[model samples]
Target: MSYEDAFAAMAAGTDEAVANALELFPSEIQTISIDGADHLLITPQNLDPGLANHLLIHVHGGAHVFFSPETALNSSLAAAHAVGARILSVRYPLAWKAKFPASRDRVVAVYRHLLQDYPANQLAFYGGSAGGGLILSSLQHLLAEGTDMPAAALLLSPWVDVSGTGDSYAVMSGHDPVIDYPVSLASAAREYAGTLPLTNPGPSPIYGPIESGLPRILLTSGTRDLFLSDVARLQRRLIDAKIPVELIIYEGMWHVFQTSTGLPESSTAWRDFARFLRTAWAID
Candidate 1:
């Protein structure tokens, strides 16, 4: 299939996933607009009105080709229930429809709009895979612009180095059963990068200056994840810069295994995330 056709085929598969997510994690989804952009506001079961002041913004990850704001409800619901707060899943334009800074800029705009009613400390961001990478790069964009920082962020199996400049890419080529880098994965990166160079630090935040304007970040990856090296390198870079960061590695798990939710490992990851957010928000 052509690149465009491949992306379409990938997107076409989102319906069943969204349906499954709904059935697996029942929640209320509202389409709220930030200016003109529509985002998914998920109020999962066990939501606490007392924690209404705290907000979680999510960006879904599907190699920037699959999954939309509404389609990302599975994890959004899981996160809302985990933290007992509402989540706004940013509906940034996908790579196939818009490339490069479009995803980053749209998120920045949504954040800026939300800043009107909520203090930066009241907000936190989370995403997995491309979504996590997008959050990282968008923060880079915000940093370059000298914007206020949020309380913290959770990046689950983040694909920080979209340039594919990591040891795991080579080592886990045959190991990661979920992601086949040699297949259409590279092409998806190209689709996301478009005219931009893969290493511009826009598409690949690993090359960006993350030393400042960043809140504490929690990054998780598994030994079998293709982006394990990316997470490890990012952790080292943050530590070298004296940034408050936490790295959690799970054994025998692959990219975004936290989404499985049924695994004991996934439960631990979410509980750890809850503690991280509690500390960031100063919630006892």
Candidate 2:
């Protein structure tokens, strides 16, 4: 099937669509609460009981507008199972209800809470699309406060630049079937930030400085994705800062293809994510 067709099939709806897409991967899902907010914890039922010490904190992608922790439950579970780790999927406040600093603050708070349970060295941050943006933004916020960062980070098709300065924003415009247009993304970012600068490091992390000693990052993107250039440029900036980063570019794929675990691309991406998690955390 073509990229357009694949995206159309995946964009149907978060609950039914995502659950159906991830049915092939088995995960144990449960509903829980964090910091007074409801969340979903997804873990592979067959995970080695001994490896539960390792944990992955996942933020779901919805362009900061759609989806919820329940929407990404299956994928998070599969990833945790794939790496034999536990998963925490945060149901963060959305752009429409809570704007900048607010949304970013909630995520940072959750990360801080997680640190209370698991050592920073044993935890990893995982997110995709807008969630990817959140992960980077949260790290910058924590680092500025001298807080501990995660051991590593995994970002899939990250929308790093809220400024939308990426060359591929126009180059891949028509080629990317999932994202409607750059205007829509920009509008959401503007609304999410309210009066905050679009280029603010905590708002658009691609324009921000990489913190020294931050966690190593594994970034994945597709050539056809609208955020391709943003991902590439972020990687370049990270490398220039002497930060450890691994980038994987999938040919002809669109944003967050791995969310569609039914596809071969999604399967490969998850396998890579699992391996990266194990290596980053030094899981035996």
Candidate 3:
């Protein structure tokens, strides 16, 4: 099979898994069009003052390749349930189809449109895997454009440095079962970057300057996650830039393991996540 064919096959297989996963989170989801792009608006019954009238902008993951629009909702299921807020999950185009900055720019445009409807203080970002990296890079663009930032962001196993320069890439080469570096992410990263360099910082935020103008952030990853190095490195970079950041490393977990709603680790992680959101929003 061709490369695109293989990606499509992977996506088709993942779609079923994601669909099954969605059933685990009982939320009312509605699909709306934002500037002609699809956005899934999800609302779970649980309510929190921290999320009252607040919006969580969710970016979904698939290494910029796999995962469909429906699967995007599944990726943010934890956030919808934990945050107990209305979430607008942007259905950014896949990198294989739209190229490097296309996916990044689509997310920014959705954020920009949401800004007009909600105050920056009432908006925050939540994403995992590639979505996490995308959120970081997109915020960099926002800072460059002098745009106001949201209150907070939470990333789960974000692949911030797609260049595969981190220690985890080498150390976890034989460990991380979720991703095989040479066979998986390495190729996907290149496909996502398209004509641009992998270390462009626009796609790989770890190489970029993590300056001010970013919101308070939280990042979570598993010890066995291939992106562990990415999250750890970015945590230090954000701290060096004086950003209020928090990092949590779960024991014996893999990349984006939080998506497995049935896992015990996932339960604990989402509970911990709720606490952070409450603190960030000063819900008390």
Candidate 4:
């Protein structure tokens, strides 16, 4: 089914959609309330409690309308296992219910609460799809609020431009297996933006001026991903602003294709993320 059709089905009965999505979640993961927001904490089965210094905050992607933290735990689990770090996945409000800034603020609040126990330097933020845009926008918010930024950010197939102006959106249409053009991202972007302009830095972060003190960013994309323009533009902007950036493009892959387990390319992508995290923390 096309993304638009899937979204229509999801909107028809959000509760059922959410319930079905949760089936993908690992049963062993623990759900907890953090600062009044729902969060899923996923740890390796053999993880030692004492080895909790390194934390990865995973922001899930559902085009701002579909999955919750619980539903998207599979991706977070993959990341945690790959990096050998604990994953704290945030469950923020969705756009269909609360609109743009609510979810962004929730992320900021969750990060602030985490800082009380974990140092900013010991934490990294990882997100894919819409979650990737959240990662960038949240960092922009953190900077504006004068809070210390995290050590690094990992963005997979980041949808950094809500404006739907990217060239790939036009050319990559049949080539991209997942995204379905103005209907998929653009419609959801309108719902999320609400009263705000799509180009508002708080929404479409690619439009924002990258300033100093932002966290090191590792952005990955595939040649066939519709969001390739989004990632490319953000990487260029970061480079222009002198921020540390690692850009990886998996040739012939689709959007957030690393979520597919067992493929050699997927393994390489996950390893890249783990390596980036290790280097950020000086992990041997």
- The prediction achieving the highest lDDT against the true structure is 1
- TM per model? 0.94, 0.91, 0.94, 0.90
Q: Candidate 3 — what's its lDDT?
A: 0.83
TM-score result, candidate 2: 0.91
Write down the lDDT of every candidate, Cα atoms only. Answer: 0.85, 0.80, 0.83, 0.83
Residue lDDT tens for model 3, 1-284: 65679766867777766676567667778888887787888887675655668888888887878765576655676677876777888888887677889988998999899898898988888888899999999998998999999889899988898888888888888798778778788888998898889998888988987998799999999989988889889999899999999899999999888877678998889888878876776774
After the best TM-score superposition of candidate 3, give how far the Cα of residue 201 lies from its true spot, in angstroms: 1.1
Query: Candidate 1: misplaced stretches above 4 Å?
Result: 2-20
* Local accuracy of candidate 2 as per-residue lDDT tens digits, 64-95: 77667766765676677678787889888877
For model 4, the local distance difference test gives 0.83
- Residue 221's lDDT within candidate 1 is 93
Clash counts for all predictions? 0, 0, 0, 0
Give the per-residue lDDT digits (tens) of candidate 1, residues 35-114: 57889888777777777888899999988887777656667777777788889999888787888888888899999988
Q: RMSD for all candidates, in order, please.
A: 1.8, 4.5, 1.7, 3.7
Please give the TM-score that candidate 1 achieves against the real structure: 0.94
Model 2 worst lDDT window (10 residues): 2-11
Query: Model 4 — which ten-residue stretch has the worst lDDT?
Result: 18-27
Candidate 4 to truth, TM:
0.90
